[model samples]
Target: MNIPITNSIRHGRRYRQQGMVSTLIALIVLVVSLLAAMALMRSVDTSNTIAGSLTFRQSVLQEAERAYVDAQQKITFTQPTSDADNAPLGYYAEPQPATARSAGDVPNVLVNAVSGSIGSVTPLNSTDNSVTYVVERLCPTSGAATVTACIVPGASLLGATSSNQTSDNLTPFDNGAYAAFRLTVRVNGPKGTTAYVQTILR
Candidate 1:
């Protein structure tokens, strides 16, 4: 009878040991699941931040177009003459520095143009984004746009004297018939987002 009692006690001890091991495994699984959940949440937050940034950038780009249109209207209605430096109207008969069109941080020329009495400011959207633009004729000096002084699109590559009459039967593309103008639009948005859009027009 004593042997049977001892054997029953050993069986009880073995069952308790198995139960403890099972509990430990469950606790480890729970910890691992919690860590995974935390990682997933972080990933989702990162994705949301990236998406929001992209959307904001796109909106800023669209706002730039509005400024561009305003510049166009100014050019059409005001009709800049051969005179240079129409600062009040944001029209310059002379070309801008290369730094204005460079990539990376905002150019000093644009900052000065916007801050000073040059370029007109127009509100972009309800978010308080504003735009300013400067139009620069691609010419070294003021007065009339000459072939040697200005950048003319579709100008004869062979030479200024070369005529296209034989090939296309059309009159020779005049090298200095029209001048090319560069439109630089700067946008200032919320959270200190600054963007520049530039285009050449003839």
Candidate 2:
């Protein structure tokens, strides 16, 4: 019969397919390896970006502290005038509110500190990492202790003016009036990094 010839042809084709099977498997393995390498590279890139951001934030924070101290010194020693205070000096008796985004903040100088744009605030440095600061007396405006939010110890309070050697329990306090001052600092650095810092002192 012709059956033997047909069977031999079929066996030859199967043998050819077996020979190419290894090549097909090798191609699939190569594709998978390439995908894995790409994924690993992307993960590495993301990690690097995060680390860079953290480093930049820390640097800007240090710069902010310097501006805060400067603002506090100015508050303690002298009053800032419109003439002396500007973009470079960062000192202001009044609060500047952030206009674009208020969130639920009350419309006041204190709220302005959080919601308003400081506008080219006083630059602390000449470089790109320059910082700025503002000083505000806690009161809505400067005035007398009765009219303003000043805190002062009473003269009749014990230990206000007592000497360590004095056994007098009736000793009165003599500390002068003190007012709270708030300092706000901002810094702009490389990579669009920005930071804000606030400190309060009396």
Candidate 3:
């Protein structure tokens, strides 16, 4: 009878110890699973934030390009009246009249407008944003000359003596001339991404 009692007591203690160990292991697993879920959620949030910033940057770049093209067209079609001498119109500058020549003396106008506008849509870490752009025009030749002289000689048809003969006053251009008039654009986004674009008109 004494041996049987001792055996039963030992069995009871062993059962309790096994139950405690199992419970402890289950609690540890539960804690680890919760931590993993939280970490995954944070990572997803970060990715989404970066994607939003990139999208906004792209939109800003498009706006800048539009502004560049509009300025170029103004320069091409319109003649520079006396009002444009001291002031010049640009991406960010005040309105200046485009340069012009006599009815037909103008060379093929190369719209060489360049821009370097840089600003953040949002603060580096903030949610709100703002942007800025800079615009400039490049001359066709090295020295300062009237817009008319820039075109190759005989390229103008307005002064031609024979009204019956229309001169194809087109002038050939080199890569160097084309490169001389380039527009540069820079966009900075939230997070640390940046975008740049360059355009030229010949």
Cα RMSD (Å) between model 3 and the true structure? 12.9
For model 2, how does the per-residue alpha-carbon lDDT over 59-122 read when each residue is reduced to its tens digit? Answer: 7677766776665454332232321233334444433453333222122333334333332334
Candidate 2 or 1, higher lDDT: 1
Predicted candidate 1, C-alpha RMSD: 6.0
Off by over 4 Å in 2: 1-8, 19-24, 73-88, 99-128, 144-176
Candidate scoring better on lDDT of 1 and 3: 1
Model 2 earns a TM-score of 0.58
How much lDDT does candidate 3 score?
Answer: 0.40
- Candidate 3, residues 64-115, lDDT tens digits: the string is 5664655455443212321132113323112223335332111112122223
* Runs off by more than 4 Å, candidate 3: 1-5, 73-131, 136-142, 145-179, 188-195
Badly placed stretches (over 4 Å) of model 1 are: 1-31, 76-82, 98-107, 112-114, 154-176
lDDT of 2: 0.49
Q: Which residue pairs collide, candidate 2?
A: 87-122, 97-112, 97-116, 98-115, 98-116, 98-117, 160-173, 160-174
Q: Model 1 over residues 1-202: C-alpha lDDT tens digits? A: 3345888899999999999999999999999999999999999999998997888778767776776777766654222353457767777777655463354233356766545535765674576876777777656677665555556545442243321122332212233245556677777777787777766664
TM-score of 1: 0.65
Candidate number of the best TM-score: 1
